[model samples]
Structure formats: C-alpha cells, structure tokens
Target: MRFLSRRLVMPNDLNFAGSLFGGRILEWIDEEAYIFASCQLGAKSLVTKHIGAISFETSAFQGDVVEFGLEVKRVGNSSLTITCVVRNKQTKQNICIADDIVFVYINPETRKPEPHGKTKAELDAEVLDI
Candidate 1:
C-alpha cells in the first residue's frame, strides 16, 4: 500500500546550520512508517525491527514543509519492508532530499515479525518494482 503524507518542518527540527537535524528526520521517518504499516495491516502494536541504509543529501530549512512518500516494497510471511522518501517543498520545486529508506517491522506484543496481510505473489510484485 502507498501512503503519502506531509509535515511541517518547524524551528525545533532545525540544527545549527538552519537545517533540520539528522536525528529529527530519522524520528519522523520511523513514526511515519510505523503508522503506515499499522494502518495497512489493521494492527495496533507495531515494533521496529531494523532500520537501515539512511542517507541525507540536501538539508531542509526551518519552516519548510516536508513531503514523505511511502510504500510497501516487499511483504514477507512475517515481516514487511516499507520504503520512504522525504522531500523539501519550496518555491515551486519538490526537491528529493533523501530517499531509499527501509524499515522492517514486527508485532509489538508477540515480538515477532508481523504478517503483511498479502499473498506471496502480491508481495513479490512489489519487491520487483521497488
């Protein structure tokens, strides 16, 4: 499933360079992915397993609205892979600052990989595309 959302980049998200901090961006990505995955699976408790390969390219300034484009790349029997790209929207430009974010999530109560509620073939189709 695809979930696209936007959030305001306020002053608190900025660092000394007048751009958003790396930690804040990471936190936002995690929160957004968790929400997206849970909403798709109709689950209440979503726990993060692994978050890997984060790269920050362009920096975002304070007051810039960030766009997060999210999708489910691959879903396994017990785990789902979600990808997200964050962009800075400014002056008639949608700049893709950082992308290719991946997250593996699990069921919080069971402490195991969460089912993606999709068939293997369906999951594979998404995997191939991503």
Candidate 2:
C-alpha cells in the first residue's frame, strides 16, 4: 500500500462527539481512491462502482494527522479493484479500512464501461513514475 495523502483534522471536521466525522473520512477515501485509479489507468473517465465492507477500528480527534493509503488488488478488463486504509500519521494506528473499492473505466462519449488496456506490470510501472 502506498500512502498518498495526508489530511489535518480540524474543528469543522469533527462530529458532536469531537471525533472525525465518518462521512468526512469516507469522502476522503472516495476522492483518494478515484485519484489513484485515474493515475493507474491513465484515464480521467472513471466512476466508482463499488466499495466493499468498511471497518472503523478507531477514532481520530481534531488536530490529528491522518494518512490515506491504497493498494491495487486486481485489474480487470474494465474495472480496477483497490483496498484502502486510513491511519493516524503519528502512531500508525489504523482508523478505518475498506477491503475493496472498485472503479470502472468508462467511455466518455457513451458513458459505458471500456477496457483500460492496462496490465498489472503497466500499473506498477506507473507507480514508479509517481
């Protein structure tokens, strides 16, 4: 898994209980996953197809730094499956994990799934470029 981005938790990001909001973390995960998929597939036309079971193991409070890590699990004909983990940057404690998030490459004109024409080797090579 590559830790790609970090976010600083702020007061506005907190829930009434003063921990980071679940919806906000999910939003970050979705955005990070989309960016990762776009770079790996080298295409901008992609949509999130599915996200597997999510496990919220711990809480993050305001002023904490959290990191988002993602790893490609599988590359299919038109979809890429990835796993995500968000952890506390300071302690490396996992706060949330999603086992699988699927993104489908789509034809911009037709709005239908299209082959991304990328192999695992190709995707790994792109990671080196990043």
Candidate 3:
C-alpha cells in the first residue's frame, strides 16, 4: 500500500462522542480511492462501481493525523479494483480498511463503461517512471 494523503482531524470532523465521524472517513476514502484509480487507469472519466465491506478497527480523535493508503489489487479491461487503509500517522494504528473499491472507466458523453486500454504492466511501468 502506498500512503497518498494525510488529514488532520478537526473539531468539526468529530462525532457527538468526540471521535472522528464514520461518514467523514468514508468520504475521504472515496476521494482518495477515486484519485488512485484515475491515475492507474490513466483516465479521469471513471465512476465508483463498488466498495467492499468496510472495517473500522479503531477511532481517531481531534488533533490526530491520519494517512490514507491504497494499493491496486486488479486491473480489468474497463475497471480497476483497489484496496484502502486509513491509519494514524504517528502510531500507525489502523483506523479503517476496505478490501475492494472498484472503479470503471466510462465514456463521459454516453456515461457508460468503456475500456481504459491500459494493462497492469503499463501501470507498473508508469509507477517506475515516477
């Protein structure tokens, strides 16, 4: 997994009990995963097709820094599946995990799934280019 982004927990991000809100974390996950899929497929016209079971292992409090990490699990003809982990940046304690987040390349005009025309090998090579 490659850690991509970090966010500082703010007061507004907390739940009534004072921990980070589950919905807020999920929103961050979706945005992070979307960006990862877009880069891997080399296309911006993609839609989130599915997200597997989400496991919340721990809580995050205000003033805590959390990092989002993602790994490409599978590359298909028109879609990519990635896994995500969000953890405390300082202690490396897992806050949440999702096994699969699927994104499908689509035609913007038609809004339908379309081939991204890239392979797993190509994505790997692109990573090396960085």
Candidate 4:
C-alpha cells in the first residue's frame, strides 16, 4: 500500500481508555479508500459495497501521528477492491489493517452500478502520472 494520508491523534479522538477510537480509525480508512478508488476509476459516484476483515494490532495515544496507506487490490467490471494499512508514524508500528474495501461505480442518474472498464495497469499508470 502506498502512503495516502496522515493524521495526528487528538484528545477528542480518544476513547474512554485514552486510546484512539476504532470508529475514528475506520472513518479514516473508509475515506482514504474512497478517495483511492475514485481516483483509480475516475468516477466520484461511488458507493462502498463492503469492507472485508479488519484487524487491529496496536493502539495509538493522543499526540501520536498515524499514516494511512492504500493500494488497489482488484478491479471488477463495476467495483474496485482496495486494501489499507495504518501505522504510527514515529514508531512504525502497525495500528490496523483492512484487506478488502470494495467500492462500486454508480450512475448518478440511474443510481445503479456501472462498468468502469479500468484495470490495474491503468491504475498504475495514473499513479505514475501523479
């Protein structure tokens, strides 16, 4: 996975245990995956279809900086599956991993899934362009 974004763990993002909230991490993961899939497919009318197994290996405390990484795993006719990893920037310790976040392209007018016709090769080329 390529590094996509980073965030600092703030006091408000902590849970009762004084650790980063899992829900907040999930929100970041979803947002990063959405952005990656949208850029790869060149479509903004996308919906999250599913998020596969997620494992949290460690925790973050307030003031810790975390980096979110994402990579395109697969491209279906109408869906893109991406994987993500988040880790503490200073310690390089893994925080969480999400293997399959599937996003489907939708037609705004029809509000239905539509073929994107994109391949992994195309996605790689687009990344190189950036």
* Candidate 1 lDDT over residue span 29-97, tens digit each: 888888877665556566666676676767778788887877776666666667777777554243343
The local distance difference test score of each candidate is 0.68, 0.94, 0.92, 0.93
- Give a tens-digit lDDT track for model 2, residues 1-130: 8898999999999999999999999999999999988988879999999999999999999999999999999999999999999999999999999878999999999999989999888888878887
Q: Candidate 4: where are CA atoms >4 Å away?
A: none
Give the number of the best model, judged by lDDT: 2
Query: How large an RMSD does model 4 have?
Result: 1.0
95: Cα error in model 3, Å? 0.5
Model 1 lowest lDDT segment of ten: 92-101
Question: In lDDT terms, how accurate is model 1?
Answer: 0.68
**Candidate 3 structure, TM-score to reference:** 0.95
Name the weakest run of 10 consecutive residues (lDDT summed) in model 2. Answer: 121-130
Per-model TM against the reference? 0.74, 0.95, 0.95, 0.96
- Show the colliding residue pairs in model 2: none
By lDDT rank, best first, the candidates go: 2, 4, 3, 1
Kindly list the per-residue Cα lDDT of model 3 for residues 1-130, writing each as its tens digit.
7898999999999999999999999999999999988877768999999999899999999999999999888889898999999999999999999878999999999998988898888887787798
Clash count list over all predictions: 0, 0, 0, 0
Worst 10 residues of 4 by lDDT: 35-44
